[model samples]
Target: MLLRTLSCLCLLSGVCLAAQAQEEKKAAIKEVTVFLKGAELRSESKVKLPEGESEIVFTNVAGNINEKSLNVGADNGAVVQSATFRNNYLKDNGPTPRAKQIEDSIIYLSDKRNLLQNEITAIDEQINVIRNNRKVSTEEKGISTEELKKLLSLVRTDMKNLLDEKTKTNDSIMKLNTRINLLANQLREENNRDDDPAGQITVKFYCKKATTSNIVIKYVVPTAGWIPSYDLRVPHINAPVQLAYKAHVYQNSGVDWNKVKLTLSAGNPSEGAQAPKLNPWHLGFYRHTPVSYSQPVYNQQTSDYTNTAQAGAIIGNVLDNNGEPIINSVVQAIQGGIVKNGTVSDFDGNYILKPLSPGRYDLKTSYVGYKENITTGVIVNSDKHTAVNIRLQPTDHRLEEVVVRDYKVPLIDKYSTGTGRTITSDEIDAMPTRNTRSVASTAPGVYDGLNIGGARGDGTMYIVDGIQVYGARGINPSQGSNAYDNTMGNYVATENRGVNTTFDIELPYTIPGDGKQINVAVKSAELLASYRYYAVPKMDKDAFLQAQITGWEELDLLPAQTNIFYEGTYVGQGYIDVRNVKDTMNLSLGRDKKIVVTRDRDFTMRSVKTIGSNMKESFVYKINVRNTRSEDIELVLTDQIPVSYYKSINVDDVEYQEAEYNKDSGELLWTLNVEPYKTSTRTFGFTVKYPKRSNINL
Candidate 1:
């Protein structure tokens, strides 16, 4: 009886042990709230925990994960007594099932190719055997001509069929080989050519009871980020520009964020929230020794707007007067008395504000150079997603009223992903340089646009009226002084000097290792400009039409390359270096072939004389201009004569017949009023007296 009881107890103990042991469950990625530097990953599992101290593990999570950033929790009143995290290194962190299937397909194709190759070899041998006919004996040659012809026909027929089969086999083999190679390559790049898979995360949780509970796992992983970008378009000088704000989001978190809620925060979690402490400024007795100064440093451990709807989420887009999406526009939902920070609009001008308490709130949206759009009341319901779209009007352009700007862009714009300076048309007109790059460097945080490594970031573009007039070029900056200070958040006025103008932007962008341009909306504007024609016949025969812009200084323009178009045709491109210009700035549109010009030297006016120890040589030049256009044309013909630089050489006999000559620069100007097919002529003469044997560049 005692033995039988022992056996029953053993059987009961074994069954209890079997029921207590549980298989590990995996947590599927539920949602991800991405920030600039990192992301918040949330995963859930329908876990079945055994009663009384059972272990539940989640395997195969992102490998770039910050283990310390991981958080494990449970629902259904299931308590997590203790939890531990580790990489499942013991597990074969191989390719996905799909990748393995691709490899298997490749192997199968390789075998198929081998079989086809063997068939091809057989066909080749058969063809060779048929082709190498046994040499006919002398006796056999004596057969009848009809019989020989019949034999030759039969051999040709057999050889042709064999060759066809061989060709088909070869083609089949080639196709199989190609497929095999392609699948193999696909398998090789399964993990984006990464050496090893990001190991699975093993989360061991200790729960008390066998209950169906919800598990939430969160962690931060690298290679997950987004950049702020935008597009701006304006119709006319008086019209408001349409700005499309956007975010280029990318992540290699090893999980697809398909249909998951996402959030973008201006707050940085990597940076500690500790306020900086100010130490006493002790005035120490200084010595006459060498010393250095440096800024204070607190060596701290370091550290996109996707429109995903969360509970109590507010989603919308912002636009301008023309109904165009305004990129990088700011959206704020102010509740209570707290001034809450809002999400900047994405490239499509889309914005999402979520995780809010149900209540009525004030909403505001603002764009650069545009009036703010404010909403007095917006009701947000709990567990519900609300929609709110905003529209802003552009500020009127009052020429006389100088709106002293405090920044090149909006205060929050520079914090977006990459470094780029936007110069408005007004700014370009004020400080005219040779190219967009030159003018861009004047922005507070900008530095030598040309020196920016990699593909050129979208710098300030040169626009005439509302058209993009110029292409890419190395436009060096003119004389200017800039004091730059940049930090984490977009600085409103950190170490500021000069015009405080900035592009109002939302997110920070990054240039790739290849230095590719981050497509962010830059500074742009429109100006009002007059047209005329000027020509230097002695230098270039073509007459160049120019635009004389007044009130340019008020425009605050920059030196940049100019794209010239005339009467609707693209003439050409030229540089505008305003550093050496006087009053009216002339922007040469392009050469006018309709106006012909020529400078001819007439030897008839030449005369030589020996004045004391020096010899005098005289010469004459005639500038001829003609109007090739059907109508009358206006032209300013110009020429120059040699000017004596040394006292030893004298130039006195300077005669101008139909030209105005400048004594300082030896320049002769002729304003020609030529009718259709009419000609205008100007004659100028000058004499140079120099040392008899001294050479001159005449």
Candidate 2:
């Protein structure tokens, strides 16, 4: 009985061992497959699993996949006994179902958090800009309280959304941790199973979670206002294309309209895409269409105002070198032969002139402390917009009058090259002088007492009627000074020094008296060669002889029409005639008709003389004259016997009760009368001495 029982126990034990072996064989992995979306799997063909835990790699599988979808099953109709999903397979191929859901939630919340952060930063910067703008004056700043409040509300909403996303992300992380721990515990228990003794017939399952947050940055460009323009083309493709339009860019978000930046792009969607593109279009070009949030056009029918013919004017800004506005600047417009005046610049250095007739105009600008500006040919095309920039140079306000006179005399005070003096016409009228020569002495650096540099002070060339009188021959002895003597001679003489002589001939009267006019020219420095012979007197007798012979003789004999040439050029012409002659016991006397050549300062006198052949005759007569020094002369009478010729001699009211003739030479002499810028003439007679005849002659 014991032997039979032992045989049955052994058979039952063997059967149990065989069943466990079969279960172990069924637990071994047979196949592996990975499903992936939006990702690539490593192998597309069928894959067989190894006897132990095996791994398969699925590259870049979608994060949404779950570990529960990955299963291990028997190839035949046997039950999946002790089935296991390897940890390596799960980690490399897919994620747990619950873990994947949590991960997805975290990713979505993280994206929301990032978006809120960006919005917050942008709102903070905008708020700061608004606050800074508020500090400006009411007139200078631009912005409204309503706009600022709206921006603040938007920022607050973005902050709330960010906080909500953070809370959601933390919850997702906690739930995913708890689910991963449970899955790990379940896998360990299955691996430790021991139903039969062939390696415990165990199966292990594992799942890994791979999660990532992706931020999809999408940019939706803000819509812009529409602008209309016309494109015109020529028949030839190579001809230039023309587009005509006007538009404006304006700030919409509480920013400065002038300071906003703008860009433009244009293309025809159906064509070959050759179109003009303008960037920063606000500054460069304009279309006829209006833009969003922009002001209405002042005059819509006039594109650039060329044809509208409205009254146009210039609005200008005047700025200093430092770009500061100049106040109280005088603005004037020269238009239609009339000057219209205006006043100070406004606070922004702006000046507006309205309703100006459309034509060329000159804008004259002046300021108290700046140089004047003249802008010319400013054409105001009926309602057109034109801009002119003016930059002023600094000047002293006190020097306004002197700066206005642009006349500059070169080298007036400079001491470099030449030496001369300026005698204004004002000085000529104010100074005390008897003649132009004397007036010249009042000029600085001039000497008239004596000649210097071998030239007489009076010898300095007299420029009369634009003619040089230096070497003029046959000049009247009465019109000008002898040049060697310090005094110019007088034509009329009187007893008392201070008495005005009625018989005195005015120097310039000689020209008009002879049916001509006298116009005096300027006087300048004279040459030395002309007056060298008269430099020294030989003796008093020689001097007296020269005075009587050449000086008085020439003054009485020439006519005004006689041409006086200087180096072969006809400068002037005139004549002088001596008419009446008288004979005395010691001298002969004559009255002369004098004529002067103004171009050369020449004068001459002419007279007729006759002698009788009837009887013996002789005579000696006394003559007296005055000198240039205002002294009287007494001359001696010497030869005899001509009582028959006494009727030809006459003295008509001779005024010299104080010795008028020189006694030695028996000639009449008188002080020469000099007048300013004029020529003087006088009529006087002198006695000539003669010897008595011994007997009667034919």
Candidate 3:
């Protein structure tokens, strides 16, 4: 009995030791919640666990993950002991299918190109041999004249054939070279990095008994993000506008998301959740000091609107030392130690850093296997697009570690449409902001758009110190901001979380690891809109058809570029800035040639007089709207009289017919209905009285 008891104890000890052994398993990404700046990925695996503590290693995960935001869970009453994340440099996350295809084509073309060059070289060598033997050797035995002539003729024929072959081979090589360059361009567009390693998650779990447990893993990655855009289509003037909401998703997060459930969140999890604190305000006398700045060495052209605080943009290309385009290279605009906006270079290596206030900024460009290039003192002038191309040098060694960086995109992309309101010096002076960036932010074109890094409220909720806090939450449906509607939730489900909105795509999507924009439909709605023709002849002589939509808040719209289509025709592009929308959402359709508008100064009513120390100038302007279309149109004509801020100048005797005039702004508006092939005219006159010592242009 003692011998049997000792044998049983030894067997039990052996079983326990086997159960505590470490096991490696691969996790499949099941879902992904992509934020404006980051993405949360959820993966799952099933593994058999033994009764004691077992170390489970999950392989083939996103290498660009934020380790602090990683979490692991298990079923079957398994208790997780510890979880850690590490870069798996050995794991092969092979090139994407498109990239592989391009690589194969390039290789095949390159081989052909080499073969053609070899053939050309042989042909040249044969030609040289024929030329060298042109002269007969005198030491050699004498030969017949007829034989010599035949030999010379044969050598000439052979040389001609060789030259012809060389020409053909050279042509083939040229064609192959062209094809190889095209394939290279395509590969760059794919933005595939073959050496991008996978990540691993090591989790230690304790189980009471041996059983198969379902394991779930979640983590946040900063390399993936999405941008919002819209398609606004109006069939005709009387039809309701069809709004198609879409998301432009992009990722470079090592792991390819194949048929994964996707959710797009407007809220950013990278932004700080801590509320900002205000410092104590103090009043002090103004100190005059001279400010100096170093000019950009590459570009020395000064802007004309710099003093007006107009928004500007920087457009450039990211290239390698060999002048090859570097796709998806991160470009950041840094101002005063803070990164203002960031963007990645396109497939063509072009990047646009937009909506920057007229000021000096530093540009930093980074890529995976290249040395970072920092260009300081890049001047962004008002109402201009500055070109600043950057060249990144390739690294000599492989990168063993991945460094994660935050990238922020501009709120307003003025360069896209080549249209934006310029803030004047007076407007900047009236603004409460003290800095140039703040003044630009307050400008009319700025939008509340997507960000790649930084934290925002309402992203994820957490419990801190037994108190509920708004923090990182992922994978759990209770915390997920998935959008849904009773009837319209088939393709996309939307949820309004007050601070931000989320669109959960119902269908499975296969977004590759390539850093390219994948368009996803979010929501579609046909909203009723009223149409009217508007024109400000003083500024522009063209009449624009505008669509006004009421109750636009229910659309859950974000600030994005909107493609306008009217009357079954594609119109110009416009911007939908939900942050600036109020009682009505007015969209401008393209100009209408059918409605002719003209503004002319009425010389008969214009007069100038000097009374004592004061000079009075009277100006009258007439605006005519001619509706040449078959249908009658309603036109709103607007003209403004100069508003004086000084007490010495006063605008008086403002006269108009059937028009509304604002007293403070001195703006005149006339709403008129004109029949087809008929014309309607309105005239407004105002008198400006000022001291004779001052000169004013009217």
What lDDT does each candidate get?
A: 0.53, 0.29, 0.67
Q: Rank the candidates by TM-score, best first.
A: 3, 1, 2
For residue 408, what is the lDDT in candidate 1? 35
Query: What's the true lDDT of residue 19 in model 3?
Result: 45
lDDT per residue (tens digit) for residues 164-212 in model 3: 8888888888877876776676566554254555678889889889989
lDDT of 1 by residue, 1-698 (tens): 99999999999999878635635666677566555545677888887766766666575566546666778888876777755665454556566654666766766777878888888888888877766662352146567878777777877899889888888888888877766666655555553423323345444555555678888888876445444432222222122322223333445555445445444433345555588999999898987984322322222111122222322667888876556565545576776533232556764569877555578888877543566688877888765668998877655432221111113332222222112233323222232111123321111111222210011112344432222222211223321000111221241211212332222233333222111112322223333444446777665676765555455454233332332222212222233334545566555444556777888889887889897789999989888888777776667667787787899888877888777878899877777778989888888888888898889778
Q: Summing lDDT over every window of 10 consecutive residues in candidate 2, give the lowest-scoring window.
A: 530-539
The candidate that wins on lDDT is 3
lDDT of 2 by residue, 1-698 (tens): 99999999999999877644532221211111100001011112123333443333322211211222333333312222333222222222133332344345445545555665566566566656555654442335454777657656665666556556655655565554444444444333222211111211123212232212111111111111112111111111111211111111111110011211122122111122366787873565756974342323332111112223456667888877666555334455666434432333543568765445577888877642355698999877666545666777654211001000112232222122112222221121122111112211111111222100100011122332232322222234332211112122232221222321111112221110010112211111111111000101111111111011122222222111111111111111111112322210001011101211111111232222334532222222222122332222222211111122444342222222223454443334333333323443333322232233423221
lDDT of 2 at 672: 37
At residue 293, candidate 1 shows an lDDT of 21
Off by over 4 Å in 3: 1-22, 88-103, 110-166, 181-198, 272-490, 497-499
Whichever of 1 and 3 has more lDDT, that candidate is 3
